[model samples]
Target: MGETFYIKNMVCNRCIASVLDIFGKEDYTVESVELGKVSATAGKKTNKSALASKLKEIGFELIDNETETLVEQIKVKLISKIKSGETEHLFQSLAEEFGKTETALSKLFSKSEGMTLEKYTINLKIEKVKEYIQLGQLNFSEIAYSLNYKNSSHLARQFKTSTGMSMTEYKNLKSWNRKTLDKIV
Candidate 1:
């Protein structure tokens, strides 16, 4: 009932669905599930050692290192917060949940993922901004504010840096490239 297992690349909502689907079909009643772990129900035990084999058979991998596990948890939480429009509320909440300085989280995130956490976060914000632009419901200032940017110019600066073009240029580019999420799991 208390067994827990770690999964590699459990970085997004789809990854969450993937893990739950596996347990559902296998008829294993899961006690709980989170970014990097699944707790097994006592009478419904499934071997943790075998999860690696089974998970990979379905495309997820199990990560064993302690540091990678922590990094992935942070990444998943950050990604979800960004996706759900909760960016401004996350910093204090996350510092408490992880029991570490945001500086510490940023350093570990950069060390593990080969990019600054701010860069990763801005990439996601840009993606969402682009979505709003495409939807035609929000103008630049509104989009910037919704994403917690200091101002439209700041959002424009970040958008340009990440995609090598201004948000206006990106939308008007002869060819538009949709952004992809990082493989943070």
Candidate 2:
């Protein structure tokens, strides 16, 4: 049997590849590597803490508890959905997707991550909006529609609240300031 380790900040394909490379360099036999979890057969002398330290050096962290692991899994799924260019859904749908009750998941997420899932999703959407704006391919209304916001003004209000700048101000700035998916929280 192999041990499964949950990792924070492994939210993309590049992250998956990077983690596999780290396991390879350390001579660990990785049975599977997914967005935020890795299953590996442990060697006789494997050092979990040392491997964890190595992961931290590259902006990842090992999750030890079920609550923390679940929190990271929720984050990974939410981030993936936001980046997939798909339609948005209610929190109930998210709960159904994870096979958990919405109330339980909401409490766990708020307790473990210090933010409600709704706030986290909003932050993720705001980050995506910044990316769209940076590309300069869409106006505010278009960006709003693409992101499933009710209207351009609604998106602008959320963006301003999150970034302390209006969409126009963000566009007129000398440089773009954007955060990556893993760094959003």
lDDT of each: 0.76, 0.87
Superposing all C-alpha atoms, what RMSD in Å does each candidate have to the true structure? 2.9, 1.6
Best by lDDT: 2
Candidate 1's C-alpha runs over 4 A off are 25-27, 42-50, 57-59, 89-92, 173-176
lDDT digits (tens) for residues 60-123 of candidate 1: 7777788888877777788778877788857677878899898888889889989887777777
Give each model a TM-score: 0.80, 0.91
Each candidate's clash count: 2, 0
Give the distance in Å from residue 33's predicted Cα in candidate 1 to where it truly belongs.
2.6
lDDT of 2 by residue, 1-185 (tens): 78898999998899999999887776689998889999998777678888898899999999998888888988888887778756467577779988999888999899887889889889999989888888999999999998888889999999999999999999999599988888877
Which 10 successive residues of model 1 have the least lDDT summed? 176-185
Q: Which stretches of candidate 2 lie over 4 Å from their true place?
A: none
Query: lDDT at 133 for candidate 2?
Result: 86
The local distance difference test score of model 1 is: 0.76
